[model samples]
Target: VNEILDLLYTNLETYPSVRTWVFQKVETVYTLDVRQISGPQFGLCFNASHLHSEKIHEFLYTKLSSKLERDTLALWNLLISLLAPDPSTVTGVRLTKYRKGKRKDNTGTDAVVDYEMDNENLEDGGKILDHEAEIDEMAVHDLGLITVVCQYLCHIASIMAHSTNMRCNALQTAIGFFLEASNAPKTVCELLAHSGMSVSAATTSRMLGPLRSQCEMKLKGLG
Candidate 1:
């Protein structure tokens, strides 16, 4: 899986046309920028955009209709369609105004008090009338399909990028640390490591040692 994903990412980067298409697509929703890195695989980084996910996905489908493998394209299309946001649903946070309903019980000043005599009972109904509705901030939009796709792709990319390099695999390294904290047995640790779910137990222990030293130093400093 790691090798497959890594190959896919490398292919994505190597193809100038694909890179340009991706850049154009993402630029619709997020501000795009390219950054150079010294990494062996990745050379440039770009930002996401502000364009609507629906349009972006549509454009993607149109462009890759004949290019991607039928199964892959079908899966992509299915995922996009399934995750697409409903037009009726709200998309983001916005301030909205609403009125509080009036209550029905209190008497007005003109109503007859026990000490005063009045012909008719004037009702106030405990109504507090305000001309303006209360304003509230709330989320109006559902999560964008494109946003989810981009984030999912990014995480997958991160995992694949570090798959072979456990020393720099932050996600797996964190998982390894969690396993260590739980005192998982060597067999279990090795199983997960071999499965590419985390760094090896040895690497976890090596990392923990430095972290432990730093923690001890901090504690001594307080003393």
Candidate 2:
């Protein structure tokens, strides 16, 4: 199971297009399972002995949460989709005032609906109004929004550049074979696999020196 999971995480970048679909399908499976187990009519038979078992619920939740965290690229894609301006909303004419409900002519309605739907789906969407200026003002007020957006974009760039050198085979082999291995050996092998390199331990150590130094410098700057 760990090997399978490590493999999935390693090749996640290769399936970028299908990542969203995969996430949705996984969510759907969980939802269906939850519904079947907890539904009123089926609750008794499934209770404790079957789907509603405490152990199973805990395991499922743990797996889902871990997957959500590990699948950073998928989360980044979701964030981009959320932040992107809807095509339907970009109109030549800016209405001086906004009103709710369907427009008599459906020409501009699609854009409005799309924008609203996206906003509504967001975690804090309810707090945000449909006003363009209001949304911009909120974004400006929240420095965290800027920080999060920057971090997400940086992650996307790292994935695109394949900078992390975190790969499936190396991860799986490390987890599967080196459960008892020393940290130094595991780290060295994983790095080699991820980077597709054949460097000696001394060379790998030398390469990390500058990277660590840069990180410390940035930390000091932030401080």
Candidate 3:
């Protein structure tokens, strides 16, 4: 995992494009069911739906250690590009510092206009724009990204608390899909198929008891 993360960071320049593809794939899968045309099909559709989901989880976990880190890094890079500072000016500042007795803003009774022309040239070029626009743009982007990541994380937590609470209601959806798939030995087979478990009616009934109790307890606590 460390090696994989290192490799990803080493090639982090490709992250934007990779993130775009991953986001699109995740959205498509979450919105549409891969089980629609089921007959043990295994191809791009399967890989795109399942394998891509796994990859997305891995990438998100690896890239975003905490909410702060993810939001900060993305915003920082966007802001940096938007600001677009002049390299020459930065280099000139460093060079000036390196030259001894060339103190910035030097003052004396006998003064000299050593860099007068340089200052005049810049002044004539017009006012240098501050990065207010870049800061605003970054604020908007950061807010949007943070909102998206938080919403998804909350959704996952909700689903984990109660499988039935999945944002897309996957458990209920699976049950409905299975029932619609077949009718023979209807209830038993359908429940077993949907739940991914083989058991008698009594066991099936008991299986949901704990979950139901948990939901009721959570609701009561909220109240």
The per-candidate count of clashes, in order, stands at 13, 1, 0
**lDDT (C-alpha, whole model) for all candidates:** 0.43, 0.41, 0.40
lDDT of 3 at 37: 17
Q: Write the per-residue lDDT of candidate 1 for residues 87-174, one digit (tens) a residue.
A: 3232111111111111112432333322221222112211211222222122122234344554443334334445534333544565
RMSD (Cα, Å) for all candidates, in order, is 19.5, 23.3, 20.5
Weakest ten-residue segment in model 2 by summed lDDT: 43-52
Residue-level lDDT tens digits of model 3 in 129-214 = 23465346546755766566554442332233223222223222233333444543757665654453322333334434554576
How many backbone clashes can be found in candidate 3?
0
- The list of candidate 1 runs beyond 4 A from truth reads 1-155, 164-166, 185-188
Tell me how candidate 2 scores on lDDT.
0.41
After the best TM-score superposition of candidate 1, give how far the Cα of residue 16 lies from its true spot, in angstroms: 19
**TM of each candidate vs. truth:** 0.35, 0.21, 0.20
Model 2 per-residue lDDT at 110: 42
Q: Which residues of candidate 2, in runs, are more than 4 Å off? A: 1-137, 163-204, 208-223
